[model samples]
Target: MQDDQNRLNPSPRQESILVCVSYGPNSERLIRRGWELANAFQASLTILTVDAQDDNQYSEARETNMSLWESLSKKIQAEFLVAKNRSRNVAKTIAEAAKEKQVTQIVIGQSARSRWEEIAGDSIINGILREIEHVDIHVVAVQREIPLQQEDYEPGVQAYLVKDGEQDILQFDPPAKDAVQGLFFQSIYTDFNNGVFKVTEPGKVTKYQIFDGTVTRKLSETFSP
Candidate 1:
């Protein structure tokens, strides 16, 4: 099952990441952050939704929102994660998944409540911290308030696809980074090549014409493969 070709560029058992999604006002925000951290580490992601005992019957609403969120995640360039729901031992389930999946990092949405308050209240996150201790954890604050959208802003850490006609990575010595309007989403002329693509950060232009709808996995054919 392990062909040399297939084993090429083996990803060092990529650190799987578990993202806990509480279907509250912060679910979308947390998932957005989950995608960001996962991409940065080149790790796989798992989305878990916990069903805490609540007063409202939100099954239908949760499903619809999750469906829309999943569909919208594809366009954001995140390696889509499948959703899992559980009605009991939510924190324990998250910890179990992390161990079973060989997860290296757990990304959680930092809540705005004290640990005591969370413990006394219905908070899966605080419980998770108490239950899991084997993996590295990253907590992201939902500072922007608004969820990220394709038209608005792209997450800083993201991957790209290499189409058949793509130019790969562009080497440009920009006059200055401030010259471009966007830090990681500005277009480039490519020396009159009639090609325009996003200027990845610092100053690397990735042409829009080349990627044939496949995620880029090669640094150079000689070394990458």
Candidate 2:
């Protein structure tokens, strides 16, 4: 009876999870999924992002995403790591990080590439599997409902929003000292400064609608992508 009880009630298995993310709207969803798995298995979690380009060359959206990921990692008590990939092999970099961390499981978001692109090129999943042994990988499906398109907007620039009786005004030039500072992305299709306004603070991104150089809605009415 004692032997049977010991066999049935074995000690908990040790686990470590690694979450790979890129600069996109789905990154947060992947991180959250990894966190859930970590909690379920009582595993240590690490969030990793591999950058092929130098930090100085990162776009405004990439920089903002990195900051948000770091903040989220801290809030969730997970280690956040950034790997600079000089060779531009993202899969190899991820595998190396997993080995160093002794990760048993990895969580990654699904590729955004079209079906034809996936068939023409080697998948990152296959590459990671080739480099590692005895590790489980989870690929969360990408969300198709997000409406953000980074390519549609110009490069982000420092801007301000000033409250003018019942409305907010967007200004590219220097504004009063009390105005809020954030990055503004103007639409390439529009002649006026009309695009997404993103205010990225620690662990949060607040997005507002901009039309004709004016904020048209409240923060609560706008999306956070």
Candidate 3:
């Protein structure tokens, strides 16, 4: 495999390489692959992510993943960049970054989208090819994360969390008068009380998980007044 790669490239040194990553567990793999290639060629490596909105506009999970990716990039001695593409043209943003960095090679994950899906909206891979010139684009195949079995909790039902003494228990039925009310989403296939309970805040709806039989701290704060 090494000989094949060496022969294909002839000159085995790449000056600058950029990796484009999206949200999800596949990002780690993309970064590692990019790092390996960069190290092999003694090239500069940069990681880039494009978002339609600012970080604050994204979910906590998205922010957490971004932080993780940034930390991993630092550990690998690669530059990390994020661009806000309000028009949602992720390919154009990445292409622009590649041009600015003078990236000789670009590494991106293969799209999980099916053929029909690509027909609806042009694939990001195709978009990048059209926008960039003379850059060797390496498409890394990625595995989709298997979702966890939802057998730990009962099927979701409209429920409520009621404070009993110092603890809060989930009630599948409606609460009595003056009882703190919120929308409860139960987990699948369990007898015990569990899953996220959502309550409206001043301007947003905050969700808290009910573990065992208690309201989380965030839930407590929402109804403190």
The total number of steric clashes, by the backbone 3 Å criterion, in model 3 comes to 6
lDDT per residue for candidate 1 within 1-225, as digits (tens), equals 578867786766567776765543444556556667777777777665544535355577666546644543554444444334444555666666677677777776665223223544656555666777657776666433234333333233232322234423333344332333222322121112212234344434332321122222221121121
Residue lDDT tens for model 3, 1-225: 999988888964458999987765466667778888999889999998876656567587676657666766765689999888876566788889999999989988765333313433767777778999888989888765446552434444566677787766777667674455667666442234545677766656667656454664443334434
Write down the worst ten-residue block by lDDT for model 1: 186-195
Off by over 4 Å in 1: 1-13, 52-58, 73-88, 112-126, 143-225
Error of 1 at 14 (Å): 2.8
- TM-scores of the models, in the given order? 0.44, 0.59, 0.57
TM-score of 2: 0.59
**lDDT string, candidate 2, 1-225, tens digits:** 999998999876689999988766566667778988999999999999887667577588776767677766876789999998886567788899999999999998775323312533668888889999989999888754345644767899999998887667898788856787889988664456667788877666778767557775433333333
Off by over 4 Å in 2: 1-12, 112-120, 145-225
TM-score of 3: 0.57
Native-to-model Cα distance after best TM-score fit, residue 115 in candidate 1, in Å? 11
Worst 10 residues of 3 by lDDT: 111-120
